[model samples]
Target chain A: MQRYKIKISYDGTDYSGWQVQPDRVTIQQVIENAIKKITGQVVKIHGSGRTDNGVHAVAQIAHFDIETQMLPKALLRAVNCIINPDIRIISISKVSQAFHARKSAKSKEYRYFIWNGDQVTPFLYRYRTLIRQPLDVAAMKKAARQLIGRHDFSAFTANPNREVESTVRSLGMLKVTRRGQEITISASSNGFLYKMVRSLAGFLIRVGEGAVKPETATEVLNSQIRTARVPTAPAKGLFLWHVKY
Target chain B: MQRYKIKISYDGTDYSGWQVQPDRVTIQQVIENAIKKITGQVVKIHGSGRTDNGVHAVAQIAHFDIETQMLPKALLRAVNCIINPDIRIISISKVSQAFHARKSAKSKEYRYFIWNGDQVTPFLYRYRTLIRQPLDVAAMKKAARQLIGRHDFSAFTANPNREVESTVRSLGMLKVTRRGQEITISASSNGFLYKMVRSLAGFLIRVGEGAVKPETATEVLNSQIRTARVPTAPAKGLFLWHVKY
Candidate 1:
């Protein structure tokens, strides 16, 4: 069997999430169904990670093993043609047998978009989180700096479905920038816990609103307590930006 | 009666268009219904112009008269509170009785967005027209220059419901700019004919793709013929950017 890595992009608005469930529609299930029709085999593709409902993806990486001898270009075209319009298979390439989508990933970057405006533009209604309250971007930026290194991010994780071995993760980057009424929070890390990025977004927004102090990030990390964590930002605002090998 | 000039914005992806039609939903109908519910009176609201099906607007100007004693701010809040999320009443101000929504307009700026990319993102699925072909931006810009200034634009208008008295319209500006895979065509004119911008978009795209010569605009204007017009671009790409008085 040959392993093929595929880069995907999807609008996760109508999807339950990435993983397949008993009766719910999911990004993984949709693609798998398309693959099953094409190859006439049950193909289980492994995603780098699962995104929550309503979260979007610009470049999600996944891999699957197949015995078919089809070329990479033909496989990409065939899969994309059969899949839903909301999901796109951007590229596909043959990877080594040892390449695992989740385990081999060096880092993943997530972006959270906030429309810090009085009204949400209809065109941007599905993508951004509109906040009526004015944000202190400077405070948010300062809070981001406190999360730049390795820490036991247990406080930043949401309720996980399974028991996690460890919650320690290294942050490669984190920052906030504002353009017009749009505020974007970009975060990159070697690994992330389930809903970690969403939790971070909520915590930073509270800092921006002056509801929490700028040093709240450091306090939460040092304490390593989940009870002090802020509410998870809405799933619509989160996007899986990139998965780097 | 108090005349109110309101600036509106809407996502036209779901509605039929701006004007009311039998057995169809529209931006105007939704707003009018909101007004009717707020005031318990039948009122006629006049829009600056009609936008075709699936055409969006960021700053469309319109006027309506009401006998309510409520202030402009209260009226604005009440109307917006009831309208659907896809449509937004941006601002409302009291206008003189002489301000007619259609006749009092000076210039209208329309923007057409093209996602000239290999793949369309889910976030921008409803807004931009995706084109897979590589377009010549320089050629498109040159063709746009030929459409500027006063000329008989008979060939640009499509399927007008009424016979136009004169097809001559002064174009203030027309240009194309690209940001990454997104190409925007911004057109400002004293007025536009029915589906005029869409016609222009189709014409420019043909020129960009080398299907039509750059000098075709001049030839079409000189001919003063309606049958020589190119195909109308899709309605989803066109937006009423602004209505200036």
Candidate 2:
């Protein structure tokens, strides 16, 4: 069977997340159904990672096995035609047999957007978190610096059903920038735990609001218990930017 | 009575465009209802222009007169609290009694977006029109230049309910740019006839597809017949970007 790597992008507003459930519609289920319609075979798609409901993705990588003699362009067109309007198959390429979407990735980048202004813009409200208070850029930056490098990030993750061997992860970069009424936080990490990015954003927002000191992250990191030290920001503002290998 | 000019933004996907109709809910009706809830007075909003159904606006201007004494900021918050989440008031300020949202504008800009990519991005599908074919950008630009200048645009407008004094309007600029799979067309003019921008976009798209020649617009303009033009494009892809006074 030949393995194909597909670049995907989706709006998670109507989805119950990326994973398939027995009853609810999901991003994975929709794409998988489209693929089945095209190939006439029940295909299982493996995503790089899962995003929660109301989240969005610009470029998500996934891998699937299909025994086909069709050319790349033909396969791309066929899949896109079947997918129709919702999920986009940006690019499809044959990958090495040993490649795995989740395991082979070296780093992942995520962006969180905030509509920080006196009034919310209706056209962009769904895509951004509206915050009336201005964020302190310097404080957020200082707090973000503490998150870089390898550490046990148990404090930042949310409750997950699955088990993890380790809670330690390396963050390559975390930066925040503001343009007019929009504030964007971009983070690159080896991998993320469940709700890690959202929780981290919530922590930084508290720092920016002067509610917590920049060094307060160390306490949360040391204490792995789930508490009020940090709160998970809304899922609407988070986006899976890209997956790297 | 004091007249206030408010800049509004709305996602017109759920509403029946900007005007009120008996059979459908509109952005105007929603805002007016919210205003009435706050002030207990009937408020009629005058917009820069009426946008077709499913057409979005980034900075659509409107004006309403108020007889009550209330701070602008407090009034804005109160009205926003009453307005549904789908619509929002971005900013409000007192305007001269002589100012009218429609007549005070010197020029207006509209943008039409088309996703000319091989795949449809679910996140952007609602906001952009999807065209699968590879568009000829240079050819489209050459054709768009012929549309700039003052001319009678009778052939490029839809059938109107009322008679207009003149069909002639000045075209300030028309620019088409493509970045990756996204194509953006920005058109500016002193004013527009009903369905004029959509028809112009439809005409340019046909030219880009080699379905019509660049000189076809010249003939259509001189014909003074709406039947000579192509179909008007969909309203979902059009956005009233900004108004310059």
Candidate 3:
């Protein structure tokens, strides 16, 4: 068996997510099926992490093992040819047997887009969330600074699917930037809990709207409890930007 | 009856074109239908020009007359509510009755986008044309400069639907710009003939690929004849950018 690491990019609008479930069309299932057709073997691929439905990915890393003699370039072409155009295999490379897609040490970056305009542009309807009212970006930026560094991010995550030993994470960066009517919130962290990024975005949005004070971010983090105040932003606005291993 | 000038933006991937036709879904038909629903009267709207199928518009100007007392903002909202999200009326304001969408235009700007990359981004597949090979932007720019002046542009047009007394048009601006893997060709002219912008884009692309000399643009224009060398670029990459009155 030979191990291969692959980078993928996907438009997740019509997909269930990165994980497979019965009778649901998912990014993982689509790629796995394409690999099965090309290699004639049932092979399972492990993603760096799962993205929820309607969330896009610019560069998602994954690893798989297969017993095949085909070169990496040929295998990449064959799999891409069989999969839908919305999901693409960006690159594939041979990796050591000890490398794991999920367990590798590094960080991940996610971006949330908001169309802060009277009406979202027609071309961007599927990719961005619309916030008709103007947002206080300065307030959002001030609030973002408080969330950086190591902390227990329990308030930022929803119910966990698996047993988690700790909710603490080292946040490397949290930035808010605006270009014309588009506002982008970028977050980078060692590891994120379920819905953590969306929760952070939602909370900051409230702060920007003047509904919550900028200091509330620290209060929420120290309380170590998820509350209604930190609403989960819509999935369509989020993109899994990069995963560094 | 009151005349109103409106700015529109549409994702033209699904519609046939900007003009109304029998038994075809078009931008004109969609807008007219929405207006009829709001005003309870069949109305006719005139566009500055027609865009082919799969061509987008950032701010296509149009004008219409209706016998109603509804305010412009209310009418704008009503029409948008009835129309699909892919088509939007950016703004509507009362205009002089003498104003005509097509006849009163001073100049129009159109843009063509090319993704010069190994693989087209998944999210941009429907919005841009992909050219996998590297292109010489300098060569394309040199060729574009030759087209920026008043000339008989018969070679740039495919076929005229209506009889034209003269093919002469003032070419105000023709610029080529590249940002990362995307190349944009912006053309501004007093007016364009059928498929004129696309034809120019196609010719420039050939020059960029070193398949044609930079001086060929003048030769083709001076010939005043449409030939196979000036291919029509794909509609998906074309956008009606702006119209100046």
- DockQ of every predicted complex: 0.56, 0.65, 0.58
lDDT of each: 0.88, 0.84, 0.91
lDDT of model 1 at position A95: 91
Ordered from best to worst lDDT, the candidate numbers read: 3, 1, 2
**What lDDT score is found at residue A7 in candidate 2?**
88
Which has the greatest TM-score? 2
- The per-prediction CA RMSD against the true structure, in angstroms, equals 2.5, 2.4, 2.5
Model 1: fnat (fraction of native contacts): 0.50
Pick out the ten consecutive residues of candidate 3 chain A with the lowest summed lDDT: A158-167
Error of 3 at A113 (Å): 1.3
Query: Each model's TM-score?
Result: 0.91, 0.92, 0.92
- The 10-residue segment of model 2 chain B with minimum total lDDT is B117-126
Per-residue alpha-carbon lDDT of candidate 1 for residues A1-245, written as tens digits (9 for 90 to 100)? 88999999999989998988899999999999988888888899999999888899999999998898889888787888787778999889999989999999999999999999777877777788988799999999999999988888878888543435877789889989999999999999988888999999999999989999998778877887777557899998989999988
Record all residue pairs in model 3 with backbone atoms less than 3 Å apart, i.e. clashing: none
Q: What does candidate 2's lDDT look like per residue over A139-166, in tens digits?
A: 9988898888898887888863344588
Stretches of candidate 2 exceeding 4 Å from the true structure:
A160-164, B84-86, B177-182
The second chain of candidate 2 has a TM-score of 0.95
- The residue-by-residue lDDT of candidate 3 on A93-174, one tens digit each, is 9999999999994999999999998777788887898887899999999999999999988888986434359888899999
